[model samples]
Target: MFKTRIILTAVILLALVGVLLANMVQRMAHLHQSDAEYLRLFKEVVAITKQSYVEQVDDKKLMTGAINGMLAALDPHSSYMPATSYDEMKVHMAGAFGGLGIQLGTKDGNLMVEAPIEDTPAFRAGILAGDHIWSIDGKPTKGVPINDCVSRMRGTPGTSVTLGILREGSKEPLSFKLVRAIIKTKSVKAKLLEPGYAYLGISEFQERTGEDFERALKTLAADNGGPLKGLVLDLRYNPGGLLDQAIRVTNSFVGEGLNDGLIVSTKGRSAGSEREMTANIGDKQPHYPIVVLINGASASASEIVAGALQDHKRAVIMGTQSFGKGSVQSVITLRNGDGLKLTTARYYTPSGRSIQAKGITPDITVEFAKKPAQPEKKKMPEIREQDLDGHMQQVGAPKDAPAASEPSAAPMDPKEQELLGKDNQLARALDLLKGVNLLKAGLK
Candidate 1:
């Protein structure tokens, strides 16, 4: 009873002191004043925390935690990022990063895969973006904060880490032992798939993505050595990065592939002068046909290309609904080595489709899975003010309106619906390409 009373007294004293200190801080901020009492209270708390706490705590961590808490109250996307997190953010915005080559984020404070980079260990290990990381080496992660869990997940090269994952439709949590390797994210992949289709996989719209794609195309052209068949641009699971890179990709399809097409043009100041860049400068429009593959994971920059192609009648877009992220975020480094990613603009397609919440509807629609039903929630694109400078305004969709809030005519047609489903969409695209090819060969 005596001990309990003592503890209660201490708590009461602490609360009183905290209230007093808080009032002082507020008054000081308002009056632009300082006092010895404020300093004394702050120092006293620091000393008490260091000397009397039950467990050791980092001062820097405590300060940062306070900052993060303050920022989090403002919005979900706005928060304090430490130096390490800031660096990773830079790498991601730049469209590449070195690590295990997996994209990860927090869901309910537990680490989950956003997606694994193609051919990386996480991909090889079959770690999917939506898989929940339940534990690290059998250590329970429930209720664990994401940052601490990530630290345990990442380690030196050649080191093995065990992950306990819970995938959708799994009977029980599965365990996988994976070795961490140095991952330099490669944004573009190209290959010859069928006789008439050259397949390309693009992970994101990173800074170097366009250059990487051109090189991939060169290799494809050199290998074919004959008349071009059709080009398949696979932009599944691509969270957009750079705006210019997206434009460059669209330009590649418009001018030099196989037929004549329109190049995307922007009109805003600082968005700058319009130039018609071609595949070969004067090759007219591409002579061959094109098919674009997109999915719910495809976002921002990817949508720009897809929307532009569809608007210009340059390529038949295929796959599921894309991520509706039409907004652009420009990362500005702060004085503390952290980054501030702020929304910039809203982008529009040549036909003026707002890719915000309403992603670009493919000319053809195909679900990712063979038989997809409604209720499987796919990621919606993040459209910002940064995404809409050049593209045409929606038929009636407002240029400055928030995503999906603008008025629309009756929903788009059936042909567009087919162009946006998953597998069926790709097959229909092949049919379109073959027709283009036959026409080019005078075989139509």
Candidate 2:
């Protein structure tokens, strides 16, 4: 009986202290003062109110609200995550967890798929990466948190879920029925392109991106079983995930020694004091010419790889401009399982080129303009950033940029995106790799 009474007393005391401390902190923002005895009385009243309040109140929720409100008052990006949210975040960073295998994000109140993982139910059912998600089953996912929506999409394998998909130019959303499955996303995919050339595609940079990429390269080399000719690294729709992965990708082509430096840096807190990540050249070194393909949708970690290769002149970059997401984000976890993913630093290439707003420019720019297609008479939705290019949020670039300036960016009157869509850049990159192979062979 005494132990139970002691436990109850401790909880009550903690509640009183929390209430008192919160009130005290509020006064710091303004001008209020209090002393001991009356302060104790105020805390006592607070405890009584909390214990006997007519309506139930979640103390934990109230505490979280206070913390979030405090941080949000400072800046737009600064926010808090709760415990439930923290676990969901693990899936994003690690890139494996229960999911529908479709990468969904919002750009203007519309839920859109950045891309779909290969071989997942979503991908198998003919769901394209750029397909927009209108609803889960029949309920609208609009205004829902991305994490919460993702959680709703995930369940045990073999569980079926209905999705309403909206693609560009479709007036009505399409119905897609998918069974939840364990999607083992392969960060790297490689195959021999012709006899001497190899083609590699990185879907997303993860902890194992380098390992997977290296494994693919080795596989290609074994299949060739001869002096390699060239290589093509394809980072088309990869949104990018980790920094270490980017470094490894760059190192693969740069080779050991000869300081064909493949990194970019920026002005730091001190002169020449910027964080420098040098290329760790590969032993195999590709043993031939190299090419890298990047589109306007490649971003962050992807940009890092492309930028490094371009800087070192290790690979010829052939494609349109890249997605200018040069800022580096850091996820800071809280006491509660939630975390704050904030842009901690702005990244630059080893050549000191800042990718912020201005993405990596290709060495040989291959502009992809839309081609004419079958005329559709449907009235299209108002053109927006998302409509122009999926995952290519080229904000902070040169201002006064005209809408539909790049023909490949959108499907306008008299033209469709066959001129711009579906590994168009990758195909061109493969052609570049083949050319390199032919040139090397000619030299021999």
Say which candidate scores most in lDDT.
2
Model 2, 241-275: lDDT tens digits are 88887887777666477566546443334344446
Global Cα RMSD, each model: 17.1, 15.0
**Using Cα atoms with residue i matched to residue i, what is each candidate's TM-score against the true structure?**
0.56, 0.59
lDDT, model 2, position 246: 81
Residue-pair clashes, model 1: 48
lDDT (C-alpha) at residue 359 in model 1? 74
What is candidate 1's local distance difference test score?
Answer: 0.66
